[model samples]
Target chain A: MSTPLISIRDLHVSFHTQDGVVKAVDGVSFDVMPGETLGIVGESGSGKSVTANAIMRLNFGTQVDVSGEIIMNGKNLLEVDDDELRTLRGRQMAMVFQDPLTALNPFYTVGNQIAEAYLIHHPKATKSEVREIVLNAMVKVGIPEPTKRMDSYPHEFSGGMRQRIVIAIALVNNPQLLIADEPTTALDVTVQAQILELIGTLQEEYGSAVMLITHDLGVIAETADRVMVMYAGHAVELANVDELFETPTHPYTVGLLGSVHSLDDSSRGALQTISGTPPSLINLPTGCAFHPRCRFELGENSLCRTEAPQLHAVGKSRSACHLPESQLLQIGAKGGV
Target chain B: MIYFVIRRLLFAVVLLFVVSFFTYVLFTALPTNPAALTCGKNCTPEVIARNEVRLGYDQPIHVQYGRFLKGIFAGRTYGPEGASVHCPAPALGYSFEYHECVTDLITRTFPVTLSVAIGAFVLWMGIGVGLGTLAALRRGRWQDRFATTFSVVGISLPTFFFALLAILVIVIWGGLLDFPQYTGFTENPIKWFSGLLLPWATLAILSASTYVRLTRNGILEVMNEEFVRLGLAKGVKRRTLIIKYVMRAAMVPIVTIAGLDFAALLGGAVITESVFNLPGMGKLSIRAVTDSDLPVLVATTLVAAVLIVVANAVVDILYGFLDPRVREKV
Candidate 1:
């Protein structure tokens, strides 16, 4: 296949503390294609934002020890210079944060902020041209009176409006990749839907790859083209969205499906919670990080505790679980229900 | 903007009037006679009453207050010593002790006082804010540790000690500096600055410690705000983001408290000026208080009161600018 938009190889991200070194992202690997909306689903503290920030080189000032190849566009992102990295961000890859309330500067007028962001990448655009684009983006994101509201500060805008402004800023440069870190988690459900719809429309218009990070399976189900399930700093499953949702091969994926299954579908019984909180990345288990939680274990599935599993194709999806072919079919069937 | 400014100015005028009236009431309500303090301790009760009649102290309190306020606003001609002394517009009063109008003394001396205050304000704020930003950026590093330690020592050491240390270092021990006392800047600018340098340095040492602590805390808090991380993700050049976004946002409360502190510093500069032997307003204020000179006392108090009001107004205007949450009534 042609090169994916992003390919991580043997990525190790660690932090040195007085207590010890914490391996936050341990030997993680994945690939995403251009124009694909890949959902990275994980609970809080699962190193989701860290992975995205690392790709954007936002981790420079932070004290993180990282080694591995983050290949994008045939270039090793790990080796990119500071100035080059800046040019890449917001122009090639923009990020939207979770808290819409604080996403914009309080002192600046919302219109000026959007205009300023647009100017950063496209410096030749005149004032009216920039304002035109800002208003269009704001209106497209469903904001009202774009002209009047543009002169207002961040506080004057509601939580939803502010999120829309943030969306406007992220799409101001028409970046090739958008990294949204739980962008809808802080807003009300109705507002979240509006923002999600905005993202969907903008993504189609711009045709940019989106790495949407959230533990909300509902969001991924509604928006992502493909989904990657992460556990303990590792991607446990990667597959096309429909294939993974209809038939998850990994036990962890099965557990996640059971927990997030909607009751409106009647086929799903009482929701099954995944039994425990996500394992801490600071001290992950020896073998498969999900081994202790997996119930479909057989002997030298003792090997499952001692040896880590790679992403091997079981059916239409790849899973990092050491289950037999028969058991994979059973897991997938159970997940489909 | 002008309407808001005018409103604030009106408030200031009312506030000054109330304060000057309160000063009059306080002196009248005193247990002893003002004429006794004005005349000699040897003067008997009859002589004191004679002096009181001559000085307008024998009049009703409101009339006495009217005369005082009139002296400050327009002018006054008081014949307390059997001769009329015409004090012109903006005159505070005739200082029987200084043998000149109190407003004239304050006017002649305000520049020196202002220079020392402004210099100290700039020194502490510049050094304090710079060190604070450095410390916050290098949070756990030696730079942070050093700043913390230095601030602790700076806050603990009294201004008198710092003034003496500088005097000892430059004047006595180092023998490299000699700042002659009481040369007004208008008379000789260079000598005036030299005379006041040690006092300004002394004033800055303590004031800067608090400012450093305040700014460090402010920057650290602003850094924690998710908006800062959002700016970073927006690819705002780190330097530009720090200056334009982070620092500007962090300056809100710091500016408010700093303005109030600057006003208070003029009041608190007594020790600093005394140690350096500078004859500025602080020293003048100390003498006025000791001698119970009503004219000088009331004049200095009024000046300090006006400074406070002006400073507060500036801070409030800045308040509307820094935090856009503060909506101006257009």
Candidate 2:
């Protein structure tokens, strides 16, 4: 896998707020292979975005407490100084935020913002070089008449166009890793499809590892090569896109897929919904955090209540559940596939 | 942009007229008679009647207001017969107390007030915006605490009291500054600056406190904006992130308030000017009031009205420059 572009091993992020500690991202481990797309799917507060932000060390020196190694090219990002991190951030990895309207500074022109990242990494680049890079990125992101739109403020552009500019800014430096935190969540469905396609095309051209974070499983289905399903700040399932869809080993994944009504479905009924809200990170459920909301706790085995399940191989994937393999397969057949 | 300016100027002109009308009516309605005050302690009822006729006090309020407007446009003569003096165009009538033209007095004293106001404006804006940004950056730290404490002291302390105390410390005790005196800029630039230094610092201290609080709040709000985070993600230097993204955005509100404060200061830093014994507009206005110089009072009030309206208009225009939403409206 070319040593995987970046490796995150047991990354933990907690915030020490005034009220108490919030365990935002709890012991997550993953790797992004070069030119591959890894989707982290979860609802709000599930820590998908937090995990992405931690890779860039965006939470450093705040109330956040981050532990464990984020190794890229044989160096721990967490241990790097401000100077090293500054050089590494946009040059090696960059992030696109969720809200395009707010993601861009309204005061500056779009071209200036794109050029900012390029200039920071290539400080010795001339003004003409910077301009070329900025124009190329704008065109690459499918912005029509890049020259005309380059000088416009963010407010002057439509929501979809603004997101395109933001994507252009992120890709300007040609970073090895691109973290998109719900890049299209703020756009309408049509625009979302276009942005997704654009991202796919650009990823192919750049050959950079992508970490796509979103709450929509549908988005992950279309764009991600591999998927990681998170629930209550824990990785509940991890698998290839086809394998995960064909047989979801985790009960939460089954519930998530079951809720999505498709045109091809033979059974016509109301969508099945998962019950109960996500557990509070401050005071999580004692055993498995999802067990209280999970419907598949068996009669004989009380281990789901007394002990937390750890990730283990099920088929071609891994899941965090204590249910026997046969029962999981039955659940998957009855719901997902 | 032209339409915006024309609209703002039209509004300003209307506002000035309204302000001047009210001031004129209020001064005329006062219990003391302008003519009688001018006539002094002379005993005869005949003298009082003649003085009223000469001063145009015998005419109705509307008639006097009309004549007053006319005098501003075209030169007019004041008093009666042989003693009547010719007041030039933009005339504001004659000051009974000083036996001088009100407009002339205002024009003479205006330069001193403007110099003081401008110097103090620079001082306050620099201190307020600079410290405010610093306090916001170092929030929850000792520097922020010190700025907060300084602001509290500035807000609560009276301007006159602060002026006096500053004089005692800087001029009398420390000899760090010269006692304020009105030296015209054209005459001696060094003396003019040194003389106004104490007044500048005193005014800055009072005004900067508010700016500090405003700036700190503004910067804090801007820091939370998503663009700031994006700037950081772009590997922008920390200093660039703050100045380019945060500070520029934060300056909008600060600049707005500063314009208004400047207008207020120009209208008169009465207490500050009085403490320093500088012959600025505030002192002139005070003298007019104590002596019951109706012409001088009304004229100064009108000037203040004009200053405030013009200042507001200027601020509005400047706001458009900072915020694109306003700029694009034109």
Candidate 3:
């Protein structure tokens, strides 16, 4: 897989808060192949965002405790010194944040904001060179009249335009990897499609591996090559998007699919839903974090209550569940519990 | 931008006229007679009546106010023809209390007050913003705790009390320097700085506490803004992020408050001036109140109003430069 542009192994991130230590991310591992999109889908507080932030070391310098190996270009991101990390951040991997309105500084012109990121990596570049690059970036992101709009502040633009500016800033450095955390959540439905399309187009153009983090299943279905379903800070399932959608082995994945409202399926009854809210990270249920919300019955002497399930091969996917592969297949064939 | 400033200045001029009219009317309504006061202890009825005619107090209130306004533009003549003393155009008024022009008293005492204001402003901004930034950067550490304690103590102490305590500790006990005295900055810059140091420190300590709270909270809030985080994610150095992203945003409110505070100080540091025995506008105004010197009181009030109005305009213009959002609106 082209040596996997970035590899994460057994990543764990915990935040020390007043209540207790929140295990925001726990023992999650994945790989992003060069020039491919990896979608991380989870509900809020499921540590999807936390995992992405950990890769960039954005979770550092706070009360967060992170330990694991994030190997990018053969260097462990978690172990690299701050200077090296900074040098790699925008130059090798850049991030597009969720809220465009706030992601860009209001005091600076959009052009200057984009130029700032570029200049950090190209400090000795002349002013004219920087301006030309900034203008080109603005145009690449579909911003009309780049020169006229360059000097406008973030507040002066519409929501979609602002997101475009943010995307422009992220892509200006032409990093090898792009981590977009809910890049369309703050945008309207129509703009969401445009932004997703823009990211896809940019990915193809730049040949940069993309890590797309969002809770929207449709977004993943539309863009992701490989999908990772996360629950309570754990990766419950990982597989190619088609295989995962057609034969989701994990009960949590099944529940997620069952909950989605299919426009073409009018015969389907009231939308199916998981029985409970997500478990608190500070104090999760025993054995399986998803057990409390899982619908399938647990037979006598079931290990689901006493021992945690580890990720294991099940059909075409890897799932963390105590159920036998045959039984899971039968349940998956039935669509949901 | 120029249009906005010009509009604000025009507004200020109208506001000054309204303010001066109010002050003139309020002081004139008082029971004390300015002619009687100026007539001295050996004054007789005839002498007081003659003094009233010369001072134009005998005219109706509105007419006197009109003449007062006119005197500001065209010099007024006092007493009879040949013996007339012509107060220059742009005159504030004649201060019979100080036996000098009201404008002259202000021009002289304004320097003292201005010296105090500038010194105190510099001290407060430097210490307040500096310590506040330090505290915010080292939040929850010992440095933050120290700054918090200092601010609480400063906020609790009144200006007069702090001034006296400062004198007692620095001058009487520690023998650090002489007691504060007003000295012209151009005459002897060294003595002037030394003389104003105590008042400056006293005023700054009292005022700096507010700014410390403002700056500390402002920085802490801005540090959490999404833009600052984005800046960090963009590989900007931590120092650059804190200064350019965090501080640049935080300084808006701080500058707004600092401008108003400095302008208010320019009106006079009343208690601080009295405690330091500096012949500033604050002390002059206080004396005007005690002696019922209406003209001096009116002039000081007008000067204070002008200072505040001008400061507000300046702050509005500065706001445009600080934040682009404001610039477009202007």
Candidate 4:
């Protein structure tokens, strides 16, 4: 994979609030190779966004505690100072947030904003150079009439267009790694497809490693080269996208795919749903975080209830579960994986 | 934008007319014999009758009101027939108590009040917004708590009491500053500043507390907004992010209150003026009211109404400038 562009190792992030310490992202590890798209699929509060933000050291507040390595281009982002991080952040890596409505500052025009992003890092760049760079970025992101549209404010653009501008801002510097955290969640269905296509095209053009975080398994199927399924702040499954979908070893991953495919083919009967809600991060269950909701034969054993399980290699993928492969195969056949 | 400003200005004019008319009607209904008061307590019936005619009190209320409006546009006359006095355009008639032109009295005193208001406004805004920004940045810490506590005390304090305390401590006990006095800025800039320094501080300290709380709350709210987070994510400098994104957004609400407060202060911080013996608009208006000088009172009230309306219009315009969405809607 040519020395992965970003290698996140055992990342942990917890926010201390009055209620308790929220273990948002715990022991999550992954690598984004050059030009590879890594899809992080998880429901809300699964720490997908937190893990991505930690790469740029962006998730900061009074009581936040983030530890472990976020190695990008040989530097550990977690250990770097703020000044270094700032310079690295738009020049080497940039982020596109989930909601386009708020991702761009409303006060400035589109062109001005894009220019500022480029100018901050390239402070010595001339006005003409900045204008050219900004206009080219706007064009690359598919905004029409780069000259005129650049003057328009965010409110003038539709939801999809705003998202395009946000993408433009992120790609203005042509960063090697792009973190798009649910970039299309707030978009309409048709617009969502277009934005995804736009992102795919831009990623190809820039040859940047894209970390696409979303809860939609369908999106991961269409976009990700490798998939990581997270449940309650932990990566429960990781494999090639095809392998993960063809045979999901984790019980939680099976249930997630089941809930979707079951709805798709209703002839199979009513939609199947995982029974219990995700456990609270503050006071998680004693065993595997998903044990309470997992539907597997060996899940009834005292070991599944009292002992925590780590990700273990099984065939082509890793799964965090106590169920043996023989038992998972049978369950997968029954569950229509 | 031009059309919007013109529309607002027209609306203000109509509003001012309505306000002045109502105030005139209410003032006329007070039942006091203004003519007899001007004629003196020992005056005979002939003197009272002459005073009534000279003052135009014998005319019907509607005629008097029409003349008052007309007098504002053109010139007008007053006094007995043998010694009729002329008032120039935009005349507000004569003050019986001060025996001076109402327009002249207001014009002369307005500059003093304007200077005080402006000096205090600059001081309070700098102190208030600065403290607020600091507090918001250090939210949940001792600095924030101290600012919050200070604002509460400031908001609860009476203007008169604060003025007195400033005089007693800064002037009498400490002798660190001189008592406040009015000096024309045009005549001597340094003296003007030094003379108003104590009053400026007193006013700034009191009003700054309110602004500190306001700015702190506004900034805190804005810092949480997604746009601000986006700015941070963009790797913009922290100072640029706060000033351009967070502080600019916070200024919307603060500007609204500040505009109105500034206009109100210009109309006259009466207690502050009186305590400082500045002869500013506030003290002038108070004297007019106590002396039953109807012309001065009505003129002062109208001026105050105009200031408030102008301030409100300015705030609306600023709002449009600050938010493009608002600009589009307007």
Candidate 5:
């Protein structure tokens, strides 16, 4: 197999708030192969966005505490100096944020904002060259009338158009990896589809690895090659997108899949829901964080409530559950909790 | 833009007219008699009546008001026909106490107030924005605490008291500067600057406190904006991000407040000027009030009203330049 474009090892991100230290991202690890899209699916407060931010070292300067290895291009991102990190940011890895409305500077024109990203990396580029690159980026993002729209302010554009401008800025330098955190969450359903398709098309064109973070299962099923299910700051399951859907081993993953309303299964009366709220990050349940919500029966001397489950191989996927694989497979085949 | 300016200007004219009318009526309604004051203490009732006629005070209120408005557009004759004094058009009024045109008094003293205001404006904005930026950048640190303390003192202390305290400390005690005296800028720029320094520092310190708080809070708020975060994530240098993104967003409201504050100061730093004993409009207005100089009071009131109106218009226009969202609508 080809070497991974980026590798995260035992990453932990926490924030010291007025209340206490909130473990936003407990020990978690993953990898993204070059040119492949890895979908990070989780509920809110699951540290999905925090994990993406850690890879880019975006949480630095803030009160967030990050300790882990984010190895990209033979350098630990957490250990690189600010100057080196800046050089790699827009040039080696760029991020597309969630809300385009506020993400783009309202005071600046779309063209100027896009040109800024290019200028930061290529400080010596001439004005005309910079303009050409900016216009080209605008065109590549499918923004209509690039020359005219470039001078327009962000407020003048619709939400979708603003997102396009944001994407243009992120991809202007053609970074090898693009981390998109809920890029479509703020957009309408139709616009969301267009934006996702645009990202997919751009990934193919640039051949850049993508770390797509979202809470939408359909989005992952349609776009992601490999899927990682996170619950309460822990990655509970990891598998190929199809394999995970066919045999979700973790109880939490099984509950998540069961909750989605399948259009094809018209006879399914009511959507199944997990039994409890996500455990607080500050004080998680002992053993498995999801045990309070798990429906499967406890085995003899069951460690489900006394010990945390670590990710282990089960068929073609990896899961963090004390439950036996055969029992999970049976639950998966049933397709409901 | 031209239409907007024209509309604002017309509105200012109407507002000035209303303000001047009120000033005329209110000052005239004072129990003191302007004619009797113009006449000597030994004057008789007959002499006062003749003086009243000569001064055009005998006319009905509305007619006198009409003549006052007319004096602004066309010169009006004062005293009897043959011995009449013809003040030029745009003549605010004739100040009998000073034996000069009210317009002339303002024109002469305006430069002093202008000098004080302009210098103070520069000082306050520089210190306020500079310290504010520092406080915001180093929030919760000693520098921020110091700035907060400075602002608190500024807001709490009365302008007159602060001006006196500044005089007592910087001039009488420290001997670092001379007492404030009004000197025309054209007469001797050095003396003009030195003479206004105390007033400038007094006003700047008091006013800068507000701006320090404003700029500090404004910058802190802008720094939290998502656009600033995006700028940082774009790998833009820290200095560039602060300047282009953070400061740009923060400066919009500051510009508006600064413009209006400057306009108010230009009308007259009433307490500051009085404390400094500068021969500005504020001192003249106070003297006019004590002497019951009706024309001078009306003229000063009109000038202040006009300044505030013009300032509001200018601030609105400046908003267009500072914030793009306001540009099209403005």
Candidate 6:
């Protein structure tokens, strides 16, 4: 529909390390629609952050080997030169890192830093105009006394406020695509709610697509429009947010949803956790990365080991397990921890 | 700030007094006799005893120290033991061996030491920091490799080795620049500069090498900081980011070490100064040692301690300014 705002195809990213090649993002494919909030769900080392960095092109010369088309506005982002990537990072796409405390220059006033973002794209802006725009951005993110706070250094702001300042810098440019990697993980729960709400409002007002990467399913449940579930660098499930929760197909997604504490059942049992650590990408399982942890333990787990399963649909949901069509509840009963 | 300065001054005074006492004890404990030095080398034993008695060397040690401390503030007149030892206002003590007022000697030497120190500090930092930034900008490239290799070579070589190598390259072998000889800055700044050119290069080579390693490491660390990456993610150009953000952020740690090195150099590098024969602080110290000029030696040590403390305080303030983390605590 109108050529997805951003499209990625068969993205493969491997990091060359001292001990062999580690496949970080293996055969990931996804798209984001204009003005939509697309939540990428995965635990640490699932390659979600790498995929986001691939879009911005700031992840350079890091022993990273990347392939596949990142078609955005009709050009593969992977092929853009460094200069164009520099321009693209702030003018078109921007990112917000997870650690709010360490995400702003300690020497600069918050106002100067935000204004720097705006001026980078429009370098000739008058000082007064830049000030106005920067303060407005702070205001939009709900910072009090925005004008005064602008001149204060990063340490002067509380953690929540610093996160807001980062958001201000990211949104000050009105970028076309925003990649926020766990932007609220550092804040208190209340502040996290406020920040998530602010980002949603900003996206709506600016009409820019958002690629929000986080492991917290609750965050996705509250904020995401459509969701992509990644496990071991592969998109195991993709569906509308409601469909994902209501009729999940991926075993990893099922484990994730069950792991999240729900309202009525919150008191009935201890919070569930997915069994086993996510596999090391350096020496991943022979076939379906999830097979070792999967159930329906077919004889020798043959299909899973010999042939990797491509994502297949079952009704309104998709899963990447080798099980043929079966009752979703039974499959989960077999796969669930 | 005023309170901090007052406390600092009080600390300096007490510290100087302690340092002076130690220097006095060490000087008195030496085998050489101050009484004989004050009288004459060939003076008879009877004459030396009379001179020692007259000079207050026979007085209790504490009383002698009290007199010496008082002399530093107001003034003093003492015989090199019943002879004539008249010193002016702001007198520290009289050196029997040097046959000169200790205060005058120190005051003259202080200016010479400071001139060399300030001049070389400016030059060394400029070259070191400039090279460091360029290397960081081209990280992983050949220039970065060159800087890395150079830093290894520069750091591995002893300070004395560099000083000698510089002398050979710039003075003796090259002959493009003359061997350094000290010229007072007040007399002729041009001559002072040229005369110290070889010394400057020598100091620069010794000092610049350390700065290059520190600065490269500092800048590289700053570049990897999360904020820097976030700064780029926010659309700031790389050049602006490097200039305004990374270097400024890196300078706090670098400046602290630089201030420490500055104070250390002020005391002197004996080998470097000796090789150059510049008659700077180190050479003065060596001369004082050989002559057993107790007052001058004590005064020099106290002067060095004061400079180091002041520099440390300045660095703390500068670090607070450059690093918000420091300012917030204060």
How well does candidate 2 reproduce the true complex, by DockQ?
Answer: 0.76
Model 3 ranges off by over 4 Å: A297-301, B42-54, B58-60, B78-84
- Judge the docking of candidate 3 as incorrect, acceptable, medium or high: high
lDDT of 3 by residue, A1-337 (tens): 3599999999999999999999999899889999999999988999999998999898786688999899998999999999999999888999999999899999989999999999999999999999999999999999999999998999999999999998998899999999999999999999999999999999999999999999999999999999999999999999889887888888999999889998888888898899989998999878888988888748545777777788899998898999989989887877732
Interface RMSD over true interface Cα atoms for each candidate = 1.1, 0.8, 0.7, 1.1, 0.9, 1.3
lDDT of 5 by residue, B1-330 (tens): 667667767877787778888878887877877787665679899988988998888899898889988998997777554666778988888877887888889998888888989999999999899999999999989999999999999889888888888888988999988887878888999999999988888899988999999999999999988788788778998888889999999999999999999998988888888889998887788888888888888888888878988899888877777788887675
lDDT of 5 by residue, A1-337 (tens): 9999999999999998888889999899999999999999999999899999898888765578899899998889999998998899888999999999999998989999999999999999999999999999999999999999899999999999999999999999999999999999999999999999999999999999999999999899989999999999999999999988887888888889988988888887888898889988999888888887788848435799888889999878898988888987787767632
- Per-residue accuracy of model 6 over B197-272 as CA lDDT, tens digit each: 7666667766777787788889989888999889878767777788887888888888899998899889865676
DockQ of 3: 0.81
**Under the 3 Å rule for N, CA and C atoms, how many clashes does model 5 have?**
1
What stretches of model 5 exceed 4 Å from their correct place?
A: A297-302, B1-11, B22-26, B29-33, B80-83
Instruction: Write one digit per residue (lDDT tens) for candidate 2, span A256-285.
Output: 998888888767578889999999999887
Q: Chain B vs. true chain B: TM-score for each candidate?
A: 0.92, 0.95, 0.96, 0.95, 0.94, 0.90
Residue B93's C-alpha lDDT in candidate 4? 76
Q: Return the clash pairs for model 3, or none.
A: none
- Model 6 Cα shift for residue A162 (angstroms): 0.9
Residue B324 Cα positional deviation in candidate 6, in Å, after optimal superposition: 3.1
Tens digit of per-residue lDDT, candidate 3, span B192-283: 99999999999999888888889999999998888888898899999899889999999999999899899999998889999999999999
Each model's fnat?
Answer: 0.63, 0.70, 0.81, 0.67, 0.67, 0.89
Kindly list the per-residue Cα lDDT of model 2 for residues B1-330, writing each as its tens digit: 778978988998899889988999999898877776555575478877787888788899999999999999997888767888899999998886887888889888899899999999999888888898899999989999999999999999998888888888888999987677889999999999999998998899988999999999999999989899899899989999999999889988888888888898888889888899989899999998898888899999889888889999999988888887678866
Residue-level lDDT for B178 in candidate 2: 69
Evaluate candidate 4 by giving its C-alpha RMSD to the native, one decimal.
2.0
Q: What is the Cα-based TM-score of model 5? A: 0.95
Docking class of 4: medium
Chain B TM-score (model 4 vs. true structure): 0.95
Each prediction's RMSD to truth: 2.8, 2.2, 1.9, 2.0, 2.2, 2.8
- Off by more than 4 A, model 2: A266-268, A298-301, B167-180, B186-191
Better of 2 and 5 by DockQ: 2
